[model samples]
Target chain A: MTIKNRSRITVFILSFLVWLALTHIGDIQEVIAGLIVAFIVSMIAGKFLITTEKSEHIVKRFFSAIIYLFKFLWEMVKANFHVAYIVLNPNLPIKPGIVKIKTDLTKDSAITVLTNSITLTPGTLTVDVNPETKEIYIHWIDVLSTDVEENTKLIGGRFEKLLTEVFE
Target chain B: MIRVIGMAFILIGITFDFFGVLGLVRLPDVYNRLQAATKCVTFGSAGILFGVFILQGFNNFGFKALIGIAFIFLTSPVSAHAIARASHRSGIPLTKETVVDQYQEDNELKDN
Candidate 1:
C-alpha cells in the first residue's frame, strides 16, 4: 500500500479501537453498527486526520508523544497550583500584559500544539500569531520581561523542544 | 486505599474550583477571568473525573469518566482561545496595570 493508504488504514484501526473502548457494547448488533460507523467515518475523514510527512519513525514519534503527554500533565498540575496561589493571595499580584515571542516551528500542526499548550497553561494565553515572522503574542498574567528571547524561553521553552521532536 | 485517594482528589478539585470561582468574581477583566476559568475546568473537572475513574475502577462508568477527562482536556483550550481572541479583537481594554501592548503595535503596523 502507498504511504497515504497505510496512514488511512492506521487511522481506521485507531478510531475503531477508540469507538470500541468508548461504547463498550457487547451486543452483536451494536458492535456491528459500531464497526460500520467507524469504517464509514474513517473512510470519510482519515485522510485529513493524520498527515505527518515523516511516517518512517511512527513508533519513535508515538513514544515521544506519550512522554510529551506526561510532561504536559505535570505542567498542567504545576500551572494549576501556581494560578491557585496567585488567585488566593491577598494582594492578587498580577501584572497582565502582552508579549511577543518567536517560534522556530514552521508546520501548522506544531504551531497549533504550541499555542494550545500555552493557552491551557494557567497564567498565559495566546492572543495572536504573526505568521510572517512566526511570532506569537501571549498575554501573561505575570509580565516577567519584555525581552523577546527571555519571553520565548519562558513560554515555549518546555513544550517547544518536545513538540519539535514530535512534529518536526 | 483507592477510595481514600479518590476522596483526596475530589477535595483538592473542589478547592481549585472554589478559587476559580473566586478569581472570576474578583479579577479585573475578561482575559484574567479566562485564565481562571480555563485552569479551573481543566484541572478541577479533570481531577474530579479522574477521581471518579479511580473510585469506579475498570468498569464501564470508569471508562466514561476517562472519556470525559479527555474531552475536557481537548476542548477547554480551544474555547478559551476563541473567547480571548474575540475579547481582544472587540477592543476590550486591559486592566489598568497592564505593562505592555504588543498586539496593538501589530495592529498599527498592519494598518500602516
Candidate 2:
C-alpha cells in the first residue's frame, strides 16, 4: 500500500480507539456507529492530522513515546509542587524575565512538543518561537541564568532528549 | 479507606487551586498570572477528576472523569500559550524586576 493509504488507516484506527475509550459502550449499534463515524472522519481529516513523515521502527517509536509521556508527567508534578511552594511563600520570590534558548529539532512536531512541555511546567512560559532560527523565547519566573547555553541545558535538556528520541 | 483517599485528593486539589488564585491576584503581570492560572487549573482540576475517578471506581463515571483529565491535560497549555503570546505582542511590558528582554531585542532586530 502507498504511504498515504497507510496513514489514513492509521488515523482511522487511532480515532476508532479514541471512540471506544470515550464511549465504552458495549452495544452493537453504538460500536457500529462509532466505526462508521471514525472511518468517515479519518477519510476527511487524516491527511491534515498527521504531519510527521513516515519513518522506520514505528512500533518502537510508539512505545518509546508512551514512556516519554510518563516522564513528562513526572516533571509536570514536580513543577506544580515547585510553583505551589513559591506562591505560598511570604516573600513571593520571583524574578520574571524573558530568555532565549536554542533548539536543534527540525520537525514541527518535535518543536511543538518541546514548547508545550515547557509551558505546562511551572514557572516557565513559551512566549514566542523564531521559526527561521529555531530559537524559543521563554518567560521564566525564576530567571535562573541569563546565558543561552546554560538556559538551554536547564530548560530544554531533559525534555528535548526524550522528544528527539520519540519524534526524530 | 477509598472514601478517605478520595477526600484527601479532593482537599489537596482545592488547596492547590486556592494557591493558584492567590498567585493570580498577587503576581505582577499578565504573563505571570497566566502561569499561575494555567498550571493551577491543570493540576487542580486534574487532581479533582482523579479523585472522582477513584471514588467512582472503574465504572462509567470513573471513565468519563478520566477523559476529562485527558482533555484538560491536552488543552490547558495551548490556551495559556496563546494568551501569553497575544499579551506579549500587544505591548504588555514585563515587570520592573525583569532582568532580560530577549523578545524585545529579537523584535528590534527583525524590524531593522
Candidate 3:
C-alpha cells in the first residue's frame, strides 16, 4: 500500500479505538457513529499526522520506544529526587547557567523529544534550539562542566542514543 | 492489596508535589523556578495518575488515567520550553548567581 493510504488507515484505526475507549462502547449505535467520525477525521488529518518517512523497522522501533519510556521514567524519578534535595537544602548550592550542546539527530521530531527529555531530566532545562547548527541551549541548575562534549554526554547522551535508535 | 499499593503511589505523588511547590517559592529566578516546578510537578502528577490507574484497573477510568499521564508527559515540557524561551528572548535576566550566558552570547554573535 502507498504510505499515504497506510497512514490514513492507521489514523482511522487509532481514532476509532480512542472513541471506543472514551464512550466505553455503550451500544452498537455508538460504534457505528465512531466509525463514521473516525473516517472523516482521518480523511482530514492523515497527511499531517505523520511526518517521518515510512520505516521498514516499525516493530523494532515500537519495542525500543517502549523501552525508552521505561528508561525515561526511571531517569525522571531519580532526577526529581535530586532536585527535591537541592530545593530543601538551606544553602541552595546551585550554579545556574545556559550551556550549548551539539546533537546529531536530524529528524525534527527526534530533536524535539531529546530537548523535552533534557528539560524534564535532572537539573537541565532546554532554553533554545539552533536548528541550523543542531545545537541545543540548556539552562543547567548546576554548572558542573563547561566543555561542550562533556555536557552533551552528561545531559543528552542516553536520550539521544535511544532516540536515534527509535527515529533513525 | 492493589488498593494499598495505589495509596502508596498517591502518597509519594503528594510528597513530590509539596517539594515542587517549595521549589517554586525558593528558587532564585524565572528559569530556575520553571525547572524545579515543571520537572517535579509533571512527574508528581504522573505518579498520581498512575495510582488512579492502579486503583481503577483495566476499565474505562483506568485507561483514561493512563491517557492523562501520557498527555501530561507530552505537553508539560513543551509548555516549560516555551516559557523559558519567551522569558529569555524578552530580556529577563538570569539570577545574579548564573555562571554563564551562552544563549545571550549566541544571539549577540548572530546579530553582529
Candidate 4:
C-alpha cells in the first residue's frame, strides 16, 4: 500500500522474474512466457506480500554475511572429509543423538542462517527449533556435551553474529 | 566447445542428483538428509543449468534452471526451519553427545 512496501514488492518480483528468465531461457517464446507468468504470479501474490523494513546496516551486514559464509564453507569441507572417513571405515563411528542447543541471535534471519548452516554440515543436523524455549534441537552424529553451549557459541557467536551484521 | 561444456554440465548435474538421492536415503537423520538433498540438488541443478547454457546459450532452459536454483535456495531453508521448529516445539530430546546450548539470550527474552 505504502510506497516503500510497493517498491519492496516490485523489487522482489523483478528479482524473481530475472532469476526465472535467466534460468529458463531455452527459447525466445519460453522466456517471454516465463516473464508473463512471473508478472501474473507477482500480481496475484502482491496482496499477501509483507514488507516490514527493518534496519540492517546493509554494507556492514553484507560483509559479515560473506565472512560467515566463507567460514561455513570451510567448515563444511572439513566436516565432509571427517564424515567421508566415517563412511569409508566399516565401523560407523557416528554416535547419533538429538541435543538441545540454545541460540543468542535476536533476528529471525540470523537464526535462520545459523540453523540452515548447521544443516549444511555433514555430521550435524538441525532437527528442531523450539519457539517457546528458543532452543535448537540438533542431531549430531557425534556429541560432546561439555562443549555443547560452546559449540553453539561457535555457531551463534561466530557465524550468526556475522550474518546478523550482514542481514539484520 | 560450447557443446562440450553443455554436456559436462548435464553429466555433472546428473551425478549430483544421484548423490542427492543417495544422501537422502542413506543419511540417518532428517537434518542430514536435508543437507544432502539441498546441497546436492543445488550443485546438481547448477550443473544442469550450465549444460543448458552450453547448448542453448542463455534462453529458456537457463531461466528455468536459475529459477529452480533460486527457489530452492530461498525455500529450502524455510522448510527446514519449519520442520526444525516443529520438532523442537514438540519437545524431542537431543542426542547424548551434545555439549552446549548457546541460545540463552532467546530463552531469557521469552522469560522477560
Leading candidate by TM-score: 3
For model 3, residues A87-139, the per-residue Cα lDDT tens digits are 99999989999999999999888998999889889999999899999999999
Q: What is the lDDT of residue A122 in candidate 2?
A: 62
Q: Considering lDDT, where higher is better, how would the candidates rank from best to worst?
A: 3, 2, 1, 4
**Could you list the iRMS of every candidate?**
1.4, 1.6, 1.0, 4.7
Candidate 1 vs candidate 2: the DockQ winner is 1
TM-score of 1: 0.90
What does candidate 1's lDDT look like per residue over B7-109, in tens digits? Answer: 9888888888887788898788898888888887678988888889999998888988998898898888888888888899999999998999888888889
Q: Write the number of the candidate with greater lDDT, choosing between 2 and 4.
A: 2
* Clash list (residue pairs), candidate 3: none
Q: Assess each model's interface with DockQ, reporting 2 decimals per model.
A: 0.72, 0.68, 0.83, 0.26
Best-fitting candidate, measured by lDDT? Answer: 3
Give the winner by lDDT: 1 or 2. 2
Query: Order of all candidates by DockQ, from best down to worst?
Result: 3, 1, 2, 4
Model 1 regions lying over 4 Å from their true place: A1-7
What order do candidates take by TM-score, descending? 3, 1, 2, 4
Model 2 CA deviation exceeding 4 Å by range: A24-40, A52-54, A58-63
The clash count of every prediction, one per candidate, is 0, 0, 0, 40
TM-score of chain B of 1: 0.94
